[model samples]
Target: MTGQLDVIREANLGIIALNRPEAINALNLEMIDGITRALEQWADDEEIRLVLFEGRGPRGFCSGGDVRAVRQAVLDGNAEEADTFFAAEYRMNGIIARYPKPLVALTHGIVMGGGIGIAGHCAFRFTTSEARFAMPEAAIGFTCDVGVNFILSKAPVHRALTFAMTGVPVGAADALALGLTDCAIDPARRDAVRAGIAAAAGAARIDAALGALMQAEMAPVGEAALCAAADRHAGLDWTDEAAIIGTAGLEPQLAQLALRSPTSLIAIAESHHAARRLSHIGAVLAADLRLARLLCRLPDFAEGVRAVLVDKDQKPAWRPNSLAGVDRSSIRAVVGAA
Candidate 1:
């Protein structure tokens, strides 16, 4: 089954599997709707106590949103449809963040963009040795949405800004260090951990097991370095900060991720610094939406997508080509109320 939203009841626990291995369990509109329905149905069910959500396949839990569709919609000039999709997606993200139950998200592999939307807000986010987390929207010439502002705000300053703008994939150690994963399990031991959850007497045992897993996977070196980098980048202006961190190799892993666009990275870094001052989620989303619309009007977005996803040409010719060309006024124009 390419897109299976399996809802199985094991004692008081509900297991929801994202079974789209073909696409690494990418979140399409249908998948989002399925998840929303499952959550709503299970929310009222007294019989179900906890929810364990996972994606099938060894390659990933959930890679991201089905952006090909969004890209196509934009190419066809159906901007309203793309906007509607993002609106619904953001609402779903908010719901997940505020969910009442003990929602456990088992993030085993590539978790990016929309994957973050599903797993980022869970009560317990579990990961494995292979787990790679990122936010690459800026690489595609889009701002981070899907309640990412909330996650960004909670993250260590420069660390959050760097990851969002660079679209870098953090390994298990870095992920734990960044507090993205509550527990880290060895890839081979993931099954054992799941079985342990199944056999646990109550939430207490599950929590204990998770705690043990996290402690076992902790990486002091990675944590300390990341924290130091965040401190170094804090309170500096975006351009100056990016210049400093980019030169210092604050995140060497970003070079290997290869999914982010240089143009998007610049845009993302700029957005984070600007959004950091905003007081509310509505303000951030509105600002992001304006930015997204402006990006569509610009040539960078389509060109970036084409170069990366269409032509498979690793090189993208950005319009501005330089950060200096992207003025504060242009950014402000996007954030300003119409």
Candidate 2:
């Protein structure tokens, strides 16, 4: 709507491109609304055969949500506004996840946070060699949301938890092996692929053909390191503060990742564990919303944002800097029944 998004019609296809190159195509409220509106309009359009989603810039598809704005809102004591934003954003994510039309997401470059929200739910998701993906909410002292709980739970056990807690980027091959991406295409072929979809017969036919094309182009390679890491940490009681930190001691990278935001890491571990037990999608989303609201009240969220973004300090003075310092009651407050 702000000219930050380009909606082009190619035969029977609707190509929705995020046009904010300056912010690496970050999803602001307007972009989210535009995408939601486009999907709703095209969902029932008889002529539209498929929806092709991509970001305009070379850096990647989308970096994530505009968290700097959300952080500023929190700093300005506008928690209510932030809550409304998340509510709308999460609703959009749910709609995309269950969209009626064929949705093909070309996810290249830095796909994180809200970027994941947009691309992760498509019927067909493709990644290029340059693509990097993650659910890095914990790094900024936030719980995973934007329907990430659903995505993570669907992933292999410890693989999901490790990704959530560590905020590490997974490459295209790793993503495919983890079921995070369906295909790995050379970035050069992106436009041709879009054109191919536009030329296809129908939405359903386009999706089926896309799967075949991906299978022909990219072969799946299993992620051994991720699998090994998961196997190593399985069944450990993450709630035991000392044990949680101690488990990271065996792996320096994991320790450093946990040290990035001890509070958020612990909170996410708890949130995901609780989410695993829920039987309904609505329940999982409600739980995530409740936790996000509570995150605004915590000091670490603000402190983490200031250190990471505002000050560019790269060091946050997280309260109780150690996991042992986190109170059980506070953890209970975040993950408690909604």
What does each candidate score in C-alpha RMSD? 3.8, 2.4
Count of clashes, each model? 1, 0
> Between which residue pairs do clashes occur in model 1?
138-264
**TM per prediction:** 0.83, 0.91
Q: Which candidate is the best by lDDT?
A: 2
**Cα lDDT for residue 160, candidate 2:** 77
lDDT per residue for candidate 2 within 209-293, as digits (tens), equals: 8877777656344454554565688775655667667777886435656566777877777788777777765666777777888
For TM-score, the strongest prediction is 2
**lDDT, model 2, position 133:** 85
Worst 10 residues of 2 by lDDT: 219-228
Which tens-of-lDDT digit does each residue in 289-317 have in candidate 1?
A: 77766666567777776776678786778
Candidate 2 global TM-score: 0.91
Error of 1 at 178 (Å): 2.3
**lDDT value, residue 36 of candidate 2:** 84
Q: Each candidate's lDDT (Cα)?
A: 0.68, 0.76
